[model samples]
Target chain A: MNIGIVGLGLIGGSLGLELYTHRQQTQAQISNNPSASPSPSYRILGISLEQKICDIAVKRGVVDEASVDLSLMSQADIIFICTPIAAIAPTVAKLIPYLQPHTILTDVGSVKKPIVENCSALWPNFVGGHPMAGNTQTGINAAQHHLFVNKPYVITPTANTPLESIKIVESIVDLLQAKIYHCQPEEHDRAVAWISHLPVIVSGSLIASLRQEDNPDVALLAHYFASSGFRDTSRVGGGNPELGLMMAKYNRDALLRSLQSYRQTLDKITTYIEQEDWQTLEKQLHQNHSDRLKFNL
Target chain B: MNIGIVGLGLIGGSLGLELYTHRQQTQAQISNNPSASPSPSYRILGISLEQKICDIAVKRGVVDEASVDLSLMSQADIIFICTPIAAIAPTVAKLIPYLQPHTILTDVGSVKKPIVENCSALWPNFVGGHPMAGNTQTGINAAQHHLFVNKPYVITPTANTPLESIKIVESIVDLLQAKIYHCQPEEHDRAVAWISHLPVIVSGSLIASLRQEDNPDVALLAHYFASSGFRDTSRVGGGNPELGLMMAKYNRDALLRSLQSYRQTLDKITTYIEQEDWQTLEKQLHQNHSDRLKFNL
Candidate 1:
């Protein structure tokens, strides 16, 4: 089997590393069973727009082969599109000419519906995936084989999606020891809007609102007092700007719904404060505290 | 010199531990210089309404002595009102009968203005102190001596406040190895509205909005999908409910202003997304990314 990875950024690079690691383990098993289902036959080929990134990826053992050309993916049984959301569809479109008859294309997009719609429209075997992992860090340099371990990896499958394609994604996630989840493309988009996409917008608004104060003294002192709470709340807002923008761009409607829900909650709290309704406000805040405890985050 | 710590919770208990450690260091210094400022002379007296908490604090050596009676604080030269914000003024009023002529009163309230107003009206030597440390964990069991080390410790002094009273609080902050910052009570309130108080409301709203979805399946799955981003963004929202409420109650006006500013930013981002203005939205997101980087948070 041959696996092709497009865009050697964090997801692609990490996937390459995990796949390579899995390949070695499978190779050890091949000594016992030459043609077992876990046969060590898969080759990881990475694709990138930057020749430099490709060379570095190969040196880092993220891939057996890498190229700037989409044609490099033609020999693979499966191809994972790990590009940014804005580039996923276009990258998939460029690879359409090279897609083999049995090629199964998938993606590690945070948003699902639009990417699924675009890619599945172009190719029938596309499965939309989202590995609910990663820190604010990005790029090839930050990638590691351990990223997906024990993390939830959701695969959004349209009715037109083949079972075999979904299982292929499951197999990779299984190799990385990630939890598997299956949901409809639209459902995945809506759910992540509240949890993932919505957080980006909410957190971004916080940073955008915090300006260097009119008084320089106050501004300097504000940073001194920002503390751990501010650091955690503002983390996602400081994530890859392009990636955050793309999530908002692709998952606009659901994210808008999430914003509305968030606004409604904020309005209620704000009105309680504005009215000096401390009892009700305290009650609401208590609910929030308990609500968060339920998640144990 | 003797120190009184009121309301033996996180701040009070931690201060007790720290003061005890400082007392030991001063004891060591006593051997070197019998008449120096570090004369090993200070004793820590802790006051709490709960007998169990008081008993446990003494047993844990958080204080040299602990008592439920307000009279226990009468012997101390300085008193730190470490009670919840909602209780600070009332606690101060109750402590007034016990305050000595030279007693210097300070507080570890997150919102300084209201507490300062009430306390200063009751006591002449009151200095508003806010040690910007502590996790969500509460009670004496969670307290440690090192909680305030190298952290920001703000002292908000009113025009009516005596320089001697401010220095007394500064000395304790210095003993804890914390960096001391002085500001007007109002300025401290406003600055923290952006960095501290506002984040509680922002984070709380995130959790309050994330409910058991209308669809139970969606609700359960949403938890599975709520990743590190959700955890970080919702952290402060899950903070001590009573503490967060008091911040909102005491610093209501400044926090309201922060909410308005945050809403305006959110409105702008929402408009861009609603209007499908990708270029503007992307630009705004880029600014957010850079804005947060400036804080290094």
Candidate 2:
């Protein structure tokens, strides 16, 4: 079975490595156990805009074969588009002519609604996917085979999405040993806006606000005194600027709604502080603490 | 030298362990090298409101002696008031009568202005200290001898503060192998408001906002989708409720000013999004990312 992966950075490169390792492990298991059914051999074909990244992917054995041409992906039984959120739609549009009718296609973009709407129209087999993994680190150099292990791999499917396409994606999820979640494209977008995209804006604005401090001495001391809490809180705000912008661009409406709701919460807490209502403030903080604990992830 | 530590929680408990370790190390070094000058023997006396915590501190050997009696702290040459922000002034007031005239007093509270103002008038030798360390974990169980190692230990001194008091605190900083930073009381409060206190409110409000989601389905899905980014961003927000409230209480004016600046930044970002000004939004995000990187801590 041929599996193709495009944009071989962290997500794509790591997926390629995991797929290759899974294939090797399955082949070994079949040889050792005669009772086990023989599985088809897997071949990973990787495509990247950068030749250096493609060469590194090949050198690191992330992919059995690497290419700069999109047409080479036509031979794969399945393909995973792991491009940046901004590029996902355009990349999928560019690859539509090369995608075989029988080949199931998917993506690992954070935002789902727009990508699913754009790509699913061109390719009926397209399934919107988002693997809830990865650190702040990016690039092919940061990719590792175990990146998706035990991570939530959400697949957003429309009513028209074929069951066979989902099955194909599920097979890959199984191979990666990742947990699977199913949701509508809109639900995925809204959920991500609150959990993923919202944090970026919240965190980014935090650091940006400090930069607005009028006092130079306070501003300089703030940089020195930022401890573990401040670092953790502002972490995603320091992430790749282009990526942060794209999430905001593609998931604008839902993210905007989240921002409004978040503003209300901030105002409520501020009022409590202004009024010196420590009881209400403490209660609100305690509730937030409980709510955070509920997210075991 | 006798050292007293009050409120044996994360900062106090950890300080006790570090001080004890440093004393032992110094003793061992002096024994090994005859040419080395002998340092004075150290004694750590820990006091806590909770008897169990005091017992734990003694059992763990974090303190040479532990007591629930606040008056017992009078015997020490120096006292480290490691109480919560709200209790620091009150705790010092209660211990003033027990303190010797020559005894130096300090605190490890996050906020310094109110603490310094409230206690410095009563005790001539009082020096406001804030050890920039600690995780989300609290209590005696979280104490570790190395907690202060390589961490910033900021001392806020007013013009009236004695040079002798600063030198005494410097000796402790050296013993803990931590870096020492000196700033004014107001400077420390303003700086912490931007870096430390502001992040707590920012993070807590992020979690608090998610709780306002009307749709239970979306809320449930958000809980499932909260990834590493959300976890990191909301970390301080989910910390001890009383601690969060006290920071807001003591650093009210500065924190409110920070909140105002932060709200402006958020409004600016939201306007950029509303206007679909991707270029400006991207630039702002890029600038924020650069600013966050500048904080080496």
Candidate 3:
């Protein structure tokens, strides 16, 4: 089955490489622009996603051919949108005319609800996709053929979404060898707000707060003392502020709601601290610790 | 040099193993609790620290001898107080009478001001030491011979402190193969307030807010999608609430100052987000990104 990937950034570029690689071992005809060929009309990323992607593809040997046109979408059985959240809608709107009638469409957006709404509004055939994979590093240059190894890829389909389309999207995710999970669009948004978005704001606030201190020496020590644990907690919080702010804004209500709920949890601990209730505090941490261990991540 | 370690918890137990391993290599005449047998200590940690420490020391051959008695202070050239914050002062008070005339004393408490204060008030021959090594995984069971490897060990000495005592503590840390950092007591607290304590409160607040959400499904999803970054940011925040509270209380004035400063920074970001100042927000985040990279963390 032909799969057309647009954007060719981190997510899109990696997907293209993976699908191209999969075709090598299987009985599939993968069409991608050649690595070295400078397409006269195609817009490659940065210098040339057209050239670099094909070179990587050839080096990794993923696709027989790669290109930069919606004509690629015309031959594809499915199309995956791996662009940024803002670009997803416009890109889909632009490609709808050329998209095959029954082709399944998906995305790798961190936020899902808005993307689903915009895609469904723009195109008759669209299935909401949210792949939960990231590194602090970004861009097509940082893309690895195995970037999504063993990561969760969520597909959120509504009542209007056809079951066949859902399966086709799932099949593509399967080809990428990622763990597939299904959830509602709103559920996806709410989940990300808690795990992904909220952490960024919290961490940014924490680190940003440090910048206010007058003691540069202690600041240096604090940074030195800041180890793996500090890095972990501040990881999401210290992310791209625009992306962080956008997540909070797009999922504002949900995030604010989550924040409210989180405050209550924190307040309980806060009260326990004020009252000096060490016993309960330990119990609460134990619960959080236990809950944390339940997830594979 | 004989090093007497009081309170065989995470820091003490780990130090025991480290000292033992280092002494063996350096062929130093280390005076410790000879009765303190060495073992894997993991099993001991699961039971009780007192027993776990004893067992681990004996099984691992960490000490020539071990004792629970305060007199252990009299024999040692240096004493390292590796206990919780609450115990540091009282332990120092008790050990002062028994310590040798020139004994070098230090601690492994998270906070330094109180320890330094207590040392000054209760004893003259003491220096404040904070080995900046820890893991979320606590207990004697988690003790390792090399837990302090490549970690910072901060030495906070007051105006009254003896430089020789500082040198002794630094030597111990160096022997443990840890990096050394020196800062004043207040400076250390402020630094921790920003990077360490701030993250804890911020992360706890974030996690606590999410727990309050009405939709448990969303909460569960958020928990699932949370990766190493989220966990790191929230690490200190999710720690023992009593410890967190005590930290705030002991360093309340400094912490409050840090918190207020942090609030201001966060307020700036919030205002930008609320104003829909995308360009400003991007620039702010870019600055934050650059500022964060300047630290060694």
Predicted model with the maximum lDDT: 2
Candidate 1: stretches off by over 4 Å: A32-38, A136-141, A212-216, B32-40, B50-55, B212-215
Off by over 4 Å in 3: A28-64, A100-103, A136-149, A240-242, A245-250, A260-284, B1-3, B13-59, B100-104, B136-150, B171-174, B238-253
Q: Evaluate residue A53 in candidate 2 and report its C-alpha lDDT on the 0 to 100 scale.
A: 86
Candidate 2 residues A24-71, lDDT tens each?
887899989978877657899999988888899999989998999998
lDDT tens digits by residue: candidate 3, B1-297: 567778776788788777777556443333344444443221111112265566666676656566666765677777778777887888878877787788777788878887788777888888887777776667666777788888878888888898888886786687678888888888888777666666666666665555566777776666667776666666665666566666766766566667567657766766665566767767767666667776665
User: Per-prediction count of colliding residue pairs?
Assistant: 0, 0, 46
Best of the two (1, 3) by DockQ: 1
Instruction: Kindly report which residue stretches of model 2 are placed more than 4 angstroms away from their true locations once superposed.
Output: A41-46, A49-66, A135-143, B1-10, B13-35, B41-77, B136-143
| CA RMSD of all predictions | 2.7, 3.0, 7.3
Positional deviation of A144 in candidate 2, in angstroms?
Answer: 3.3
- The residue-by-residue lDDT of candidate 1 on A143-193, one tens digit each, is 897898888888889889999888877887788888899888888888888
**Sorted on TM-score, highest at the top, how do the candidates line up?**
1, 2, 3
Query: How far does residue B129 in candidate 2 sit from its true spot (Å)?
Result: 2.2
In model 1, state the lDDT of residue B45: 95
Where is the poorest 10-residue window by lDDT in model 2 chain A? A34-43
List TM-score per model, in order: 0.92, 0.90, 0.81
- lDDT per residue as tens, model 1, B1-297: 999999999889999998897788778888788887756578999999899999999988899999999999889999999988778889888998988999999999888888888889988789999998987688889988799998889999988999988887888788889888989888888889988888888888888887725666666777877768899999998888887877887888889988998988888889999999989988888888777777834
**Chain A TM-score (model 1):** 0.91
